[model samples]
Target: MECPVCGEHLGDAGQVLEGLDRRYAPCHACSQARLDPRAPPPEAGQPCACGRRPLDQVMAAVHAVLADGGGLAPGAPLAAVGTPLLHPFPPLRSPPFLPPSSLILLTRYATPSLARRLLAEVPEVRGVVADRGIVPGVGGATHDLLAGCDVYAEARFTPAGPLVLYKQVSTCHIEAPRPRDPKVEATDRAVRRVLPDVFVDACAGVGTLGLAAALRLVPAVVLNDAWGPAAWFAGLNLHANREALLAGEVDLLASYADLRDVPAPAAPEPVAAARADQEILVYRGSLWDLPPLLPVAGLRLAALDPFEKDPDRLRRIARRWQDRAGGEVFIP
Candidate 1:
């Protein structure tokens, strides 16, 4: 190829630019005109470093890859002919769930062991473990250490047949049976230490908090979520804990979107019925819709983990709980 600027002979595409997305390459010297094919292909052209005409091969390869898959892994090396190579991360888990091995492979390839160690060095991750039972290392929780971790440009690895590009995490999932997010775990610890008899865990994802809360609260634990997956998981988890729940104890709210699904006490015994009647309700909804929670009767404590960043939502939810029971809410 000729340099678009000086008409000087140029090396391969790599010699022109550090990376390749399209066919055209820019001249390292002038960095002006793009060195493009004389007969540009029918497809749209990729810009070269040197400003010239558009490119062809870039789109051809990109289209071919996308039609077949998303493309080679984002950072995989190019072929000898400068064709990009795609990579994918392997599955970490098994039949249904992702295995941990994928994360191990990603950590080894995308990041150095030293970087993983550095990620482990972050105090918040361990603080989550220390404060709550949320194990920080693989199999525990996601995002505990991600607060300040640096995110690189996404990468690609093919653990499965198709090449996929995804952002690799600095930390792996914690390998705990009942791993909880830091905030929920902390709240669980607080509730367990204080009001273990009957506590409500609102917005229970996968019923982790509610499950943990159930183990502690005993006899009657109300689990609620609207997301189909979470609801499904809640049922699965509740079924797994049936022995404890049906001891005239557990109340599962698998699909309750509104207040209608709250269950009646199962046990006839005064203590068991009282425990059952002292229901802990959980639900899933948005932050703005939190107003209805204001009038809920016999409500003790509620935890609302809204995705909103607004203080008004938090204040409103808090005020609602205050009005209902003069109670406290821990918004995570």
Candidate 2:
């Protein structure tokens, strides 16, 4: 998909492998940055020591609003909350996009009202998303949206095609996407080899791995996630990448309850959604809660990309899932 603001191609994921994406940017924010020498780093959590309307100025201002305290202590690193969170998505790890406007601030701080204030006070920031609560995982999978809106979008280009995804970073796991994203690459490689009739993305964070499999011509795929937001985004991305998947009229049949309604660890018999082809089904539930939702006959391949990366756990999962669901599992 094209960038909403800059009208530039965000470039395909394939370009990244060829080392060409570094030069392909939809906005200046993700491109190479030239920091002003004048902008000194933060000292004692204060604003930047230099530059016109220095980044620290904005940082300090935001800090003052929350000085009464929730969890952010004064003098916290500029990074705790992305210091002067930039609008333009930086393509590589580089300096903060300076004087950024027409961009969104992906902050792990601030409240809703405060985010609104920052939006009015800081024109450089088009959006302010305050991240509250823990990231989705085994113990606690719900990340409460404290404030603002998530309008961020990124795409992963495989030979199959471009998979466009929109995720709320605070609620979903933030991925450092590169050409060689091990998890993405591994799943793609494995699916190609196994070419299983049914593929299950047990921990689908926006349907990346599973949808990629769908693009690879995996006939029947099951995508599930415990976290509410992740499950919904998985459904969203399924439709967003429909053209590439060659499925016409991808239908999203999910409600807020189907996603975020269930508590942590255990989910209900999930409400399922189907696309036009009726080959892919998405549900919100724990990994252990997924077998009941699968097709009965196809030889299956499941990827449990859990946050916990213990080798023993993988072995246990392979055994447990194989016994219950009758498929080989991998921790991709």
Candidate 3:
């Protein structure tokens, strides 16, 4: 019998049946095939020797190998399995997973021995680190200490532009450094398409969705978060992309409010010549107290994204803003 994927010959019907049952369709030689025809295929994906056909199964087998921590050997062929597929392959199909490369694996509370073993078994693994006390929540919860590197930098490229943030392992829980959620991004894009004059980012963690809109469409932006640490990081990220923000003709006012007593910062001055093109104001207080500090009439857009785990707060914000006048309010 012949393997349908790589055309490798199987000794007999027994071998074919055994391979199919074990999810090992392609023979060992074909499984280890390299992406480049000229280069020697590295020894990886041997455990996923499933002889499946029609390409998709082969790709799935490869994905399973990487997810299982089997590690794709460096320079092993991935294009042969990935390129021919009609649908989009998973993100894991890329390098460092498909044709494994030097990777730094991060885990929560991973011991030294476990780290060492991971490095040893996976030749492509370059380093490993144990992230301690990282919990999921809003305000001062997530931080990671890399094994070798200092001053972790998170770069996010949004539809608005690119932003770089500096983070350290501290008590404060900030949002994980990554692109904005696709749904959130889509919502923001939809709002920006209307070209609103004023935009408010309520609960702007690292200011991803809000900043994306502020830097692209709106002339003025109010970025507010209940968490001081998150607001601080948002300010840092705003400054990091200051030039771009100014070029877009947007004025930024970032604040940290507890929504109890302290008021939100006022909207940017309407007269461009009277105020700085790009200004940043950071406050530490509550967001509920921000209404008096803002203009009552002309708010064009408001994004209400909170981490309180309750839908009521979002609804209240939406109602308050909507009552003032008719404007688009996005809640995610």
- Model 1 lDDT per residue over 1-332, tens place: 22112233423212322232232223453223232333222333433334332112332323233223322243332221121111112222211111111111112111233224323432111111111223222232333221222211111111111111112132222222211246545666566555644455555544555555554544335444433333333443443343333333434443323222322223210111113433433444432343344334443555665445599977886787556545556775
- CA lDDT, every prediction? 0.33, 0.60, 0.44
lDDT of 3 by residue, 1-332 (tens): 22112233323212212322223124444433334433433333432423223233233343334434434333444432222211111112222122222233444433555445544554333344455544423434444433322123344456665545433223233334333557457656766566776666766665666667755746656666655545655555555455566633223343222321233234421111112553434334455555554444454677777665567776876787677644788775
**How far off is residue 76 in model 2, in Å?**
7.1
The C-alpha stretches of model 2 lying farther than 4 A from their native spots are 1-33, 36-102, 106-113, 130-133, 141-146, 264-272, 275-278
Whichever of 1 and 3 has more TM-score, that candidate is: 3
TM-score of each: 0.37, 0.71, 0.50
Ranking by TM-score: 2, 3, 1
Error of 3 at 11 (Å): 58
C-alpha RMSD by candidate, in order: 21.8, 6.7, 16.0
Candidate 1, residue 306: how far the Cα is off, in Å: 1.7
